[model samples]
Target: MAGPILTAGDLAVRLEQGTVAVLDATVNLGRPAHDGDHTSSSGRPGWEQAHIPGSHHVDLLHDLTDPAALYHFARPSPEALTAHLANLGIHDGTSVVTYDRSGGIWASRLWWLLDWIGIEAAVLDGGFAAWEAAGLPVSVLTPDSVTEIPAPALAACGQPASVDNVRAGRWVERADLERWLRDEAEATVLCALNPEAYAGEVPTRYARRGHIPGTGNLPARSLLAPDGRFRPLDDLRADLAGLLADPAPIWVYCGGGISAATLGLALTALGRDDVALYDGSLEEWSADGSLPIERGRADAGR
Candidate 1:
């Protein structure tokens, strides 16, 4: 399997060889407007204005999610994802590279989704910001049409572990999370929300405020350097010292699974493969009147 992280320079060379398909997976998760609508502004317009040459835009909100789901950004079924990937020209043999303006935050979500479906993909380390910083070229030209690619057979792709199984490699769902939280002894739940959001001081798209109970806040931005690249592994480990002490399972979640995927990628790079993403994240947890949520920080007794 290809590693989850790719450098901007490395991608440029791959593009020259016509060996990779790049997707701009940017999405803005800023606070809602005064009207209180949490609909995220799509990054498609920005990608149209400027993006990596030959890269296509993938709309997480529209194309990749289940349109029928009650929650925003719900994971689409494998059949749905196969169709979307085929339309995007992403095939079983294609090498996928995803990036976003906000570091690899949104890009990692696409990478995680691809991984869940048994497609090989990598996130551009540092994302578009770093690509520009390296004096790489950008393009305003859009492809006239999406190139159709052959999607792998569902059986060939292999069945992804049930969302109820957290012991599998990199993806988790609400039911799995609920079960783990009830009697978690070998797992640590990591919340990727910012301090303000985690503390319930800011307005969120969800029905409730704060984070999932028993999770510790590790604000998504904290994992990045000023330049948007991931922090050094040693530095990252230091910041997560409390959780790193134990060799237990680590489950990460964010507002709607995007930022949590970012943390998941970071953890994978740091050689922690026990990490899994809570797909519905707080989007599902908060809406239910029954699921418990917590405000402020308590020691995440790992």
Candidate 2:
């Protein structure tokens, strides 16, 4: 298979063979507004202390990203990305797999970035909790040194999102939210908020529970392996492709806006150009109470 999802036990075989590279894509939002210090790459120091054997930390926040795109962080140029991947010893032949402490939600960022660069990769199923439950080996060793090499130049990423693309792509709101329940008019608005919040639940700190109306439910966890990583590409594609068949936009969001970005990253990886990120996310949507808000039955994910 061009892309394959691996189980914790299966991953053990790959590690022993030394053909695949394991990466930690964990991210945490200490503050609802942004992914914080202990959650991102720079915070990845923990991986050195313990992680999947032979696994390298992808440093979700600090590395493998163009922070410059952010009003707060500078985006990374194509050159930066090339060098970044090289440092991790990534090659066209590398079979990349990732997982994190958080639900595959944040780890999706890693899965997406590789695909953006024309590299193939997948996330671990279930995640770390599942891995530990399986009694897989964990390690605290750091490779002696990492040599940075640049990959082919990267294409521009993280562009502004549009409603038309979202309306015409494969995506679903996290849950039926107040904005949706308030009235159909309220539900049919631009994508930028975490509908989860309005659902009257807080599945993730990134947003209020509830979501845009008429959205499907595909929680990040749906793509996970028994060990916390995402499923293989075939499986992942099968899940999302069905949604795509309908010609609906895929608008992803999470409170302050990082997780949705992660979703956008994932869609972009799966060869979907119509995907978009609600960068403003919930932070912007909640700002205007004038915007209709409705509360509806909450689906766990989409």
**Per-residue alpha-carbon lDDT of candidate 1 for residues 1-302, written as tens digits (9 for 90 to 100):** 25788888898888777777788999876775532358677898898878887788889988889888878888787777866776666656667888998667889899888877766779898999889989999887547844322222221343333333212456677887788777844578888878888877778888888888777887788888888898887888887776666677888888888888888888777777788888888878888989898887654533
Per TM-score, the best of the predicted structures is: 1
lDDT of each: 0.77, 0.51
Mind giving the per-residue lDDT tens digits that candidate 2 earns over 73-129?
122444566567665666555567777777665556566555545555666656666
Winning model by lDDT: 1
Error of 1 at 147 (Å): 8.6
Q: Give the TM-score of candidate 1.
A: 0.86
lDDT over C-alpha atoms for residue 265 of model 2 = 48
The lDDT of model 2 is 0.51
